[model samples]
Target: MLIENMKMAFSAIRINKMRSFLTMLGIIIGIGSVISIVSIGDTMRTMFADLYKEVGLTQAYISIGYWLDDVRQSDYFTLDDLERVKEVFGDEIAYIDSQSYVSADALYGRAKVKFDFQGIDYNYQDVQPVNIIYGRYLNEGDVKGRRKNVVMDVKSALQLFGVENAVGRTFRTTIYGSTDEYTVVGVYKKDLSPFQAMMMGQSDGGSAFIPYTLLTWPNDYFYAMRVYAKDDVNLDDFFGRLKVFIGRLKMRDAEDYYMATAVEEMGMMDSMMGGLSAAVGGIAAISLLVGGIGIMNIMLVSVTERTREIGIRKSLGARTKDIMIQFLTESALLSACGGMIGILLGSGLVSAVGAVLGVTAVVRPSVVLLAVGFSALVGIFFGMYPASKAAKKDPIEALRYE
Candidate 1:
């Protein structure tokens, strides 16, 4: 009997092909919108997680309290101070370096190529390893001798000298307001992912590196240092002890110091992105309610049109429950078909956009299953009133009306 009812329902839909298609449109749009949004959000979250891992999720940043009113020169961290911390921390520390930056133009003949110059210690390479393609990274000799030497990206080297091997090439640059000639000691290749490259765009000039001593000479101090803890170390406990250690080292209170970790930053970013996606997805879901209402309206119209058929079925000894189940099955099948099409359409959209943006397309099977289930439920709930009306109809009156 159930199979017969489904067959009849399918026949009715096939007879009014155009109207049936029009009725399914709302469900398709709603399901498609939700799937695309959720998939995109998941992909973005994964990209961010990968980025954080690349930058060392276990890394911690320690900086001096320059914001405090009582801040003095003693509050500043010097090379001696950095060394002392390293010696004390020993095996617990994976890598440590003081990173400082200055924006300058490297004069190569008539062209003044711009680059962000970073002052880095010997241990800097260990913290953020660079792939040296042409020459060598900065060594202890470079830092101790305070040589006016630099390392740059292959792209930057090509931009400056129109060649890949720009090592031993001299360029004039003003550092800390003093104009001096600096020699390129090395050239490194920057490997960026497809998504990262798209975000950065096509840039000719890139970052250049130099010995920390050359930039911070005379005073040789820094306000902040980037530290990486070992994998085995507990970040929370290490940072707690580090803050106190630095505070005591600088003759300041522990509360005066400020420390932030990459893990904390990643967590905050994930939370923010998740919340934003949920809010936007919720707004998009309003279409589902609209689609449900459309199903209800159409079902009501269907009941009115099929009144004579209902009366004939009742006269043939069909039960009221039988009529209701048949109508409900028809509505559910209509909604389920729309949902399947929407899933395919949404998946295609996600792949196309992900390709264009150079990010991976991620679609969860759970989300697809949920969308199909919810759409079917929407159909059944909305079809209730119409089915009830059709079931409770007076057979004589319904037959006489037509």
Candidate 2:
């Protein structure tokens, strides 16, 4: 009976092939738009999250700067803030990294290097994840003693000595007006940042790490504070505590304010992406609505064109429910066929767009199922009105109409 109903539906559509195809247009566009939007959003989110981890957005940044209502200045995050932070949330945090960037000339015996140097405290390795392959990094003693010790990246070392074993070699480094000769305690394996590897092919992040105490700043010295939490849950509590701790330090006011962390920024981005996905999905649903209307209208027209046939069936002892079921089945079959085509179109479109966007386009089973199920819902909903009208047709009137 189901097969027979489906064949009848196809016969009607076959008779009006152009009309049927045009009617399914709405469903096709709707599903396709939805897939494209979803794919793009998912791809971007995944790519950004991965890059964020690499750039340390997952870690907290405790930055300080002066602000006068709307005016902003770059005078912030002092060593005092570091001291206060350690006093408040020292146990929860694994490392306390304090660094500031400055451009200076470095002399390695005869090789000259003029690059932006970074000043780091003793506990950088504890708070940040790093692996040393050559020699030991600077310690608490180095930072406290204001020692002129420095660690060189492989590229920097190679540039100076043309080899990896450049440890124990002395280099003359200058910060501001002071020039001091320092021995290379270690050489790193890879240094990859664009600035760090300016001319090197193999360097990953090439920058020198020097002790924080060696830094000489004017009336103003600002440091970048990064705190890595012990765990995920601790991160949430840690931020709140840090805020309160800063408040106690009197750096919490709007004027002379400090931007705390990137957590809020990352969360905002995720929320925006999610909203975009929903908006796109909603727009796609409209096509299914149009497709449903097409199914309903075509089914009604088919019934009208076959009124005499319907009457004959009723006269031959066919019940009203039978007539209703047959027409409903036809409507469902039409939409089901349209859904299969739409699925393929949507999948292809998402794959192509993802490639163009330079991100991975992923389609889960749930998405496919959602599209199919929604299409079926359109059939059941729109098919009802037409099927009901056909079932209610009086056999005498249907027969007399022709």
The clash count for each model shown is: 0, 11
Candidate 2 Cα misplacement greater than 4 A, ranges? 7-18, 46-58, 64-75, 98-220, 250-256, 356-360, 400-402
Q: What is every candidate's alpha-carbon RMSD to the true fold?
A: 2.4, 5.8
Task: Give the 10-residue window scoring lowest on summed lDDT in candidate 1.
Answer: 197-206
Question: All models: lDDT?
Answer: 0.84, 0.70
Across 210-231, the per-residue lDDT of candidate 1 in tens digits comes to 8876666336577777788998
TM-score, candidate 2, is 0.71
Using lDDT as the measure, the top candidate is 1
List the candidates' TM-scores in order.
0.92, 0.71
lDDT of 1 at 245: 94
